[model samples]
Target: MDEHEQVFQMDTGDYLGDCDYIWAESERERLRRLWLHHAQQLSDFYIKNESYIAAIKVQEKVQELFADAEDNYFILMKLYELLNNSGCR
Candidate 1:
């Protein structure tokens, strides 16, 4: 299996101790990844359509949802740049 599957399997294993907490954390991570993936896709579509403000709005929600994600900050900065500069290279 790939690394993520391996890690998930390991984390959920009974011998690891605190299975409930591990499972909850794993599930939260899974949902976070799903949310980030879809949010990025939607934002990309908005950007492609020249809707920078809309894209920024979507990413802002992502930022709030995943505050610890450093990439979210960079994404928002880039989006703001695009909005102000109108497509910076």
Candidate 2:
């Protein structure tokens, strides 16, 4: 299967089938923290490297923290789009 199909398939069992939701919130929080932490690390690295592209990418991910803070998926998607148009993807 293609990458998109593989990704969709990998997640299908979570919601499409009789799967457990015991760790869903915990997993999501874990991932959120991981992404935020890594974005900080990338910010530091980009500061040293002066990588404009990488900085923009890190900003895009940093914006995603608002998902947990305010559930602002629209803003997050906008940031993602901005980063994509910034040629950092």
Candidate 3:
């Protein structure tokens, strides 16, 4: 028997598959948080400058990324309210 085999008896394929699954999940989560941060920063900057339309666009673009997901609904609604109250269409 090989020295490596003598020390470790678990199936390598299963170990690799588990590792890949974990890495993929963590990577997806990291990307989601990153996008959310970027969207928030851009929206806040546009709103602070009184660019309500641009702020709404930013939120809408993020909504597209998430695709009808509940997480973005609140921000989208807030942006719409801001635009409506500002008379910016």
Best by TM-score: 1
Q: Which pairs of residues clash in candidate 1, taking residues 3 or more apart in a chain or in different chains?
A: none
Pairs in steric clash, model 3: none
TM-score of every candidate: 0.64, 0.44, 0.60
lDDT of 2 at 6: 36
lDDT of 1 at 67: 81
Give per-residue CA lDDT, model 2, range 1-89, as digits (tens): 24422332242222222545665767765765665565555555654565556555555545543435543345345545655776866
lDDT of 3 by residue, 7-86 (tens): 22231222243465765776666756665676667678777888878777667766766676785688778878887888
The digit string of per-residue lDDT tens for model 1 on 1-89 reads 24432333232222333555755776666765765676787778778888888778778877776788898789889888888897533
* Candidate 2 regions with alpha-carbon error over 4 angstroms: 1-22, 64-89
Residue 55 lDDT in candidate 3: 70
| Candidates arranged by lDDT, highest first | 1, 3, 2
Deviating ranges (above 4 Å) for candidate 3: 1-22, 67-71
